[model samples]
Target: MFALKMNVLMIITIIMIMSFGIFGETISKTNSETKLIADLLAGYHPKVAPTDNGPVQVKMGFDMSYFDFIDEPKELAIAHGFVYRGWNDHRLQWNEADYNGTRRVNLDRNTVWVPHIQAANSAKVTELLESQVLVFSTGRVRFYQSLQIEFLCDMDLTYFPYDKQSCNIEFGSSLYTTEHINLTASPNRGTNGSRVNSAKDFQITTLDVQRSEKSFRFIAPYSFVDVTYTIGLKRVSSVYRAKLVVPSVLTSFLILATFLLPTASKEKITFCSNMFLCLLLLIAFLHTTVTSTVETVLGQLLAFSLFVDFFATIMAVVSYNIKNRGTSILTRKDYGIMLQDTTMDGDSGMRAEKTLSTKFAWLRYIDVISFIGFSIVFVIGLAAILNQRE
Candidate 1:
């Protein structure tokens, strides 16, 4: 029993010693990496570019994660994404053997030379999340930052609801010209295999990356490298078609139906009045729902509705007047002669009815001509609106 107890104590002592040795080794290696990082940044200047001969080539890319919203009135696109920038810094290089095989190290972003990239056409200033700089033993430095950027987009709502828009998000160095820094598009310059949650009204159709140099008219002519990401957005028009277009067309047809009512019916005027009020309400609804900056297909439809309403109103008034009050085209002498003739024949009622029919026959012709004319106008307007689709 004594020997067994002694053996158990020896095993525990050995385990404890091994644990301390491993722990000390880990601390020693961490210290070595810390010392190596300090030595690398000892003579580094964060503000200046790492290259001494030519401009530092920054390979940059964007990976979009979410599309928050697009404000059509403000012409702004807000999105969440990651920005990747990588370059080489010879000063941060070290031999792995000298630092206990430390091939990579993470340093605070402010302690290293980082390219100052910004969106040139941003509607709001973007603040990037704080992140670390990854430095490899081969002098390659990589940086990643998450940001929410609001970019200004020039919108044309001419074909709105069925319209497709192209918005550009341009990124470039804020202070450094092309002579000091050059930006290039990295291989992964898009959504990077991730699903982007876009807005309900819009679907992302295309994403194109273009690199160019733009010259600025400073005291001296300076050119800056620009990387622009063009996003093509197509509107989901199902709601507008159901709510706005279909109703507007039905309202237009109802205005045409106003002419079909009997000339003697008092409901003709009331029907026209109702249609006119409906058109006014539709126009008001359009103004409230759609952007008023440009003329759209719906706008054209409303304008045509006004003309149809005006023509219908005139016809309704004429029909009511002719039906209620006898025509005065013939003079009183002619009527008196007809009355004497009818009295002599003792058929005055029949003759008087025939005279009234002859005078009011023109009302039927007016209704037919107006209906045909307005129908032609409606067909032409619909064709034009349909042809505008791109």
Candidate 2:
């Protein structure tokens, strides 16, 4: 009897311990925390035409890149982390093929493309692989749907103490057009071999030209969080014309004014030189004003300014020399006659006239060159800008 009682007590104690152990294991499994280890990458696909009784289709793809995932040591074990999914938004304007065999543009769904994972696993907890996904839409879509694709990743909390990795998402689309949409290519769909005009849907509205970025640090391990980045570019061709006409006219007039000034007033001649300096400053200011708007084409404007400054300075030098070395016409007309009675004074007048003639001759040539050069530059630059507009 004593031996049997001892055996029964030992069995009861063993059962209780086994029950508690199993309960503890279940609690630990249920409470294991997780972290999201994947980033969003997405883009849209080209539209297709319908054939036979089959529906036409469009496809968009999203690539999910993951990091520090739960180490599924078993090669065949189902590891869960991410999925690919999308949403359909609305139908846009569309038309059918015409008599010429060209179909009208028809976009069926103006929907946003979203990402959800269908299946996922890690080859190695340390290894990162891009899950390439292809999402399809029917050809009934017309006018092409304007859509935004999204990606969401879920992390497994079972793996803790690992840092999340940074991620990037980029997208591009192919062009889709029907012949009816493009009159030049009648009877055929408007599709270009060049990627630029392939899909009418991926064309962004001007309002959507700006890009956006978002980022945040995950403070809690095994917690689910998401970050997004958006990129957009504008399709624009603007004609830029630096108004050389205004500055050129101002500069030309200043150069012309130099000729109107008296030759004898050292100050008057220097004033023409000063006008040239002012032109240089104005030209410099104009170039600087446009530098930010048109960076690549500024070399021509600089060259133009330098050309004006060089000739203006030279004219200033010539004028200064004439004024200092030659007799003033007024001085010669009044003083020469007064001095004519005396041999010494008359000889001086003759010498003065000769010096004035020699010194001012270059002035005439300078005037001609400057006027022609300024006009040429102004007209050429204006003409080039006009041609570009065409």
Candidate 3:
């Protein structure tokens, strides 16, 4: 019985030690966590007056190089870069000495309140990688978010192929009024301005960038501050020059070259007809791809080729008629000359035939002159078209 009592005493001692060990482990885990929970609550809920508070200045910027392909069908521009915005709030600032110089803490997005700023014409948000909130020793709170977006651009393709376009990306708050958030084009301030550095080291790709501060109103009486980035994209038309311009010029030259053929050669008409058909085919192909609402330089060149082909066809037909209807002999009196009215000699008929043929020789000269004239016009017009943007 003494041995059993001793065993019971040992069992109680073991149980008490195990309980104390578990309790200490639990305290170690909860002690730091409880403090963090308190910090999260205190950091997010800033003690600002509920009324329409003073302006919250926001600075905004993005890298220019990430402008990828343009989506014409959807009127969207795909861009990828660091997009960060932050504002200062004194209520969330801290005294560094209280936390042993550990004033900043990263929090989940759900735990924080972010300005409801949105891309007015955005289509897709491909990725939302991360959101960071940091508090500084001076009571400054800065927030950051990195994302990829496909935003809308009112694409004007009037100069397509050779067109320059202006595209805009606008961002403004929906819930907050101007009184609560008077935004600035500069979207970062104080602490965030130094750390993220997202907008600072960006290179815009083939765009003339301009930052503007604007204001717009919704159903509410107040106006929201909006920042806009306007970019101009100039077309590089080397492909178009090869596909449209080169062929157009060659086809036009062929139309004029038909003038060198004999007036009545059926081969000349056949060749012009085939060449003209090729031009029409080219125009058809251009129409398929060049669906811009406004006509482009390439379109003009296509139209010009059609006109030249029409004129060449007319000349070809005229040549056939002139050759078929041999020129009629004219009397000497009709040639502004006087001839004696004596017995006609046998040579008269042959002489008259030769004279009539010589008069119609002017047909060849007309063809040559018209060809040169039209070709000169085409070349001059071409130089003007290509140099438009230069």
Question: Could you tell me every candidate's TM-score relative to the true structure?
Answer: 0.87, 0.33, 0.69
Q: Quote the lDDT for 39 in model 2.
A: 8
Q: Candidate 3: what lDDT?
A: 0.62
Candidate 3 least-lDDT 10 residues: 189-198
Tally clashes: model 3.
Answer: 9
lDDT of each: 0.80, 0.35, 0.62
Each model's Cα RMSD: 3.6, 22.0, 9.2
To one decimal, what is the Cα RMSD in angstroms of model 1 from the true structure? 3.6
lDDT of 1 by residue, 1-390 (tens): 999999999999999999999999899899988999899989889988876868888999988777745666667789778889999988888999999899899999988889989888887856577789999999999999898899888877777667888888899986888878889999857733236778888888777799998776772576888999888778788868888777888898788887778765678888888888888888888776666623877677777877888877888887778756664444446554443343445455456657877777788778788888888888877666555455
The alpha-carbon lDDT assigned to residue 289 of candidate 1 equals: 65
lDDT of 3 by residue, 212-269 (tens): 4444554446666666666555556675778776787678677778878876578888
Clashing pairs in 1: none
The residue pairs in collision within model 3 are 58-187, 59-186, 59-187, 59-188, 60-186, 60-187, 64-204, 93-139, 159-163
